[model samples]
Target: MSSAHELTQEQSDRYWQDGFLFPLSVFSEDEAAEFRAELEQVEKDWLAADLPLPLNTYKRVNAHLVIPLAARIAQDKRILDTVEGVLGPDIMIWSAEFFIKEPQTKQTVGMHQDLTYWGMGETPDQVTAWIALSPATVQSGCMDFVRGSHKNPILPHTDTYSETNLLSRGQEVAVDVSEDDKTHIELKPGQMSLHHGLTIHGSGPNASNDRRIGLAIRYLSPGAQQLVADRDYAMLARGSDAHSNFVPVQAPDALFSPEALALYEQVRLDQSKALAEGADSAVPLYTKM
Candidate 1:
């Protein structure tokens, strides 16, 4: 195995100061391609099952439970070490989502704070590790952050529900973000970026000829609580979940196995309920089986 990635003290400190850090090398380009190939196969299967293909596919939700590769990737020792530097040793993977923009598409992620759409508690204890599966350039909609914006309280937002908007509620921050203050978090395949939950960020439509793909894996300390009045689920990605604050999830061995699907359904439903409970804006309807 290759050497795992770890944050230098400078990198970790810079993350807290700027609210985001990028280009953390995790896997080799060849390894990233392998993962991307696996995901392509998963997408094919999803299409065969008549699942949604456009936008950030909900197939990415709790994907570790449904897709074996995603599971293993989430538990990667290097990733855990990187996250540990920011969130400590006791970590739980609260969520995972795929942000994929096809070549020359108008699918843009609206500028918004993640907590606006997430019901995962008031404290900003979560960090999302965005692992790039393909090159993410400015033209390809690489996410950019408003430097130091994470220091502010959660800002007011509006739900546009635009068809091409990639937020859960199509939400955008109500306050104006200074264009000059933005930090474009560009990355090559196999690189990753970590951003705080309260960080103001979003991406534009992919105008380039290449696809942009990223796996956003959200990690939180065990002590983080759900803001909603409903139970939530998370996989204990590393260390012990001493608080028992969330329902536990186990890794799966096959793609969409019956056991995995059943667990995923239960967790997603509970999470969706929490999302609905705390949401002040309109939520996109999720089709239940």
Candidate 2:
């Protein structure tokens, strides 16, 4: 196998020091837009069927389970190779989520590090690949990160669960960060970025005329343990699961088939409960309405 997917020494070093690297071309602009069009129709059907996106946030968790393209994309060589350069070859896809910022929406996520309540064990060795299915510009609520904050202690977060907030718990970092030091992650369609699990990042509302859609896929090393007692699942993408830290999951046979949807629902509910562990407000897995 070729090592072309691996990151350069400079790219690797930048990630270690800054907690993020961005705007790397993974797909052509045309290819990404086509992918977006295909998934957009799926979302419409999902919405019409009353099983729309996740409820408490602007997320569609584990799209790979019900969306075939997403599954294939999860295994995209460019993404995996680059990730392996940082996380090692034993990779496990913990989850794939769609974070959609609708045009002229009031939804906004607060500055907070993930892994806060991920229940994904102590080591924040997890990396999230945020791929732009649409243009992820500053005007369209692109992600913003606090430089070098990934190495800091786990900051306190308060669950607001506000209606307009895009986070599941509407969680926000309970500390002040210097705005002057913030790094904006802007990507054209087909481009992607990677960020450490502890990176303090968030985005604003979509004020542009067009929507901003991104696939925030979480990739982890097999060494990381799942902390949720009743729920543990992961799909190995490369190498052996030597530690057996997570319950192995297989790929779905068909999109939205009875079997596939059933499995997807169960896991998502389990995840939502885990996320709502210490949440102050109601955090249902998806919208009840």
Candidate 3:
């Protein structure tokens, strides 16, 4: 629970230049353990379902119930201070998604920038922080980024799901990079990596006999406008002057303190409202058609 004021200038430069930077041990073991337990509970709930696509599965993948834990981590002074140092104090949590690679599930997240999904105007201030909840290694499908790829123009690629069961889709298009220029990010639990939204990066498959779970949170500067068409999920700020385009899913009261559990309830309500209103109308930047 350290303050978020420790982001150094070197780290900022590294992120800006390379499009990604890894900070080791950002979350303490206790915090990681708490999240692990919460995820286990979520998994249990998912396993009890008989549907082809369990409701919890989709929710977990889309970062529904995980808001409580993510909010806790995002609000930690240490992380928040760093975010402020980089993006500023007026900020909004853009989007959160879980990349879970189960044992023997060979899925490679194709190389692409996160901004492509949001269809927003480009800005260097937008970044996505992927927090490793489990050990991420080459054998367990760690993420790999193209060195200096963020400096290049955005390239087009076929957008599809990461896997077709247990192997990659086996489709590759030529990009202006070599194998020698790629950097594999091997992270242990509690470690995290920050990357520019336009960074060209992808992950390997889980060849090992374990699951690889990572939580990704996207943050935007306070003034960054929401270019995405749908606005149902967008919550208008009621009290704060934070004119952010990204909506706050976790309740303000539960953002910190004794009644944190109540935040999840609010998130559930918000999610339900978004669903009833059909909020996934954001235009995709790329399509395979």
Candidate 4:
């Protein structure tokens, strides 16, 4: 019998067919509130400190490396079980980022495929588990996905790098996306969504009164490899990583530990190099936030 956390066969089938699944329950509302509290506390503490980089830079990239709370959530069994149902037993976390849109913020993510800039090729072994710490509604600018877009090869993307765009390169699919083509993915606090790496997806600005907070953890199969960079970092979330495709990442024992910060910087710089390759404009991922 499958575990309670595993997705049902029907659900798994739907995910494969649609290239995405949504509003999967993982944390309870109370538990999600606790997580949000912890994240906000980290923000508050960082704002008061003399950190070399802006807090938003860490939030956009791999906050899990420096934040114990994010690391814990990234390795949560409930989330992993669901991912395992799709990607199988062996799983590696490519990255974890906190995508937070403040109320009334105009920063938007242009519709784009996740694997387009990763240099991971057209492989379908990657999945992104986006867990919401706050309500993600249409009014709040929840993600909108193009159904069955994952099956298509990586499409050409334009690097707009617009200041109002949330993406580092403002990469948008070269094809046009009409209103009828989008499926709005709305979620309550504590719920999550899983999408294929090639799935064409993006979200609008948060117009709601509250901030829209979502932790997007990218999971990869052990067989997947990064082609652009000589080195890649990942944390083995479950099963055995027989392929040894990426450098092992250790979970932080304490928030913002010295060791963790160093690791974060190393991973960030290396990943940035891969992402910015062949780009027409400056990549904003590692820049001052």
* lDDT string, candidate 4, 214-256, tens digits: 9999999999988998888999989989888799998889877
Clashes of each: 0, 2, 5, 0
* Ten contiguous residues with the weakest lDDT in model 4: 280-289
**Model 4 pairs in collision:** none
Question: Which runs in model 1 stand beyond 4 Å of their true positions?
Answer: 1-4, 50-57, 277-282, 285-289
- Write down the TM-score of every candidate: 0.92, 0.92, 0.75, 0.97
Task: Give me candidate 4's TM-score against the actual structure.
Answer: 0.97
What's the residue-level lDDT of 127 in candidate 3?
73
By TM-score rank, best first, the candidates go 4, 2, 1, 3
Cα deviation of 237 in candidate 4 (Å)? 0.9
Assess candidate 3 and give its TM-score to the true structure: 0.75
lDDT of 2: 0.80
Tens digits of per-residue lDDT, candidate 1, 1-289, equal 3335667789889999988988799889999999999888877766657433222244446667777877788889989989988998899988777778899999998888887657764575789999999999999999989989899887888877788987766778998877797889999999999999899999998999988998899898988888763788788988898899888878888776777767776776777776554456546543253
Residues 126-170 of candidate 3 have per-residue lDDT tens digits of 777788888899899898888788886646544232344221222
In order, the Cα lDDT scores of the candidates are: 0.81, 0.80, 0.59, 0.89
Error of 3 at 72 (Å): 2.7
Clashing pairs in 3: 3-77, 3-78, 4-77, 4-78, 4-81
